[model samples]
Target: MEKLINEIDSIVMETQQITKQFQKGDEVEVTSHKLGFVGSYYEATIVSIEDANHYRVKYKTLLTDDQSAPLEELVPIGHVRPVSSHQLGTTSENRFRQYDKVDVFSSDGWWFGFISGIIEENYYVHFPTTGQEVAYPSHALRFHQEWSNDDWEA
Candidate 1:
């Protein structure tokens, strides 16, 4: 029927628009109604786009090593605006400070680093091992103690 055709077209168009808003390698928050994720947001990597609306996402917090989910349940993190520090009834002093040692997660695994700077709620971490810089959300980082070059571990 013409109505069915129109609905399908609408779905396809909407999917395309949503897909355009995200890209491979972007971090996203995935929430699933099934099991433990019922009320939590999990950090994930947008591995690839399987179709207009589905994305292959690898969960950063998988209990086992390297588990990936099919495109059906992933949502881009950037789609949601982060709450400002003031909104949490906190101030800049209560947040992570510059040069603070922190552990950041990456595709390889969790890496140790220091907070170089902050852009909004995201922290720029400098990894001493490879001299690489990466940006991670606050949830993806943890407070850490300073480490020497010889004591570093990935």
Candidate 2:
């Protein structure tokens, strides 16, 4: 029994020391679970490696604080692969026009905004929360529904 316990402890320590798929500085996206349904995904940084498959993640773009998740829930971004062709979901041309509400992926993470104009394949977006505008590729954006904010109307 003593030998068996010692071997188990050694295995645990060895597994903990193994480098995780994502490092402390790696950028990743964590899926949000609401009512047991998969919901919106938020961008985050891997703050620390809790174990072989778990990570301490920080979602600075979100209004909330940091959270932790498993490796299966993270999609690596930034210096690694950034955005892949599959993730962009641009198998073919997607139609998007001006004044359409959309969610765009920026360095600051995914944000809900309106398309102010289009310049070729890129769309100029205006975020109401920050009143900032930027041009984003169509592949990095998706349609979003409007919010009921009558008080913000002019």
Q: 95, model 1: CA deviation in Å? A: 1.7
lDDT of 1 by residue, 1-154 (tens): 4553353233222211121344678775543434422222345677776666466676656644334533234443322111111112124565676776555545433454667888997889876545678888777776542212323221
Residue 154 of model 1 has an lDDT of 18
* Alpha-carbon lDDT of model 2: 0.51
Top candidate, metric lDDT? 2
Clashes of each: 1, 0
Compute each candidate's TM-score over C-alphas: 0.35, 0.39
Give Cα distance to truth, residue 72, candidate 2, Å. 15
Q: Which candidate ranks first by TM-score, i.e. highest?
A: 2
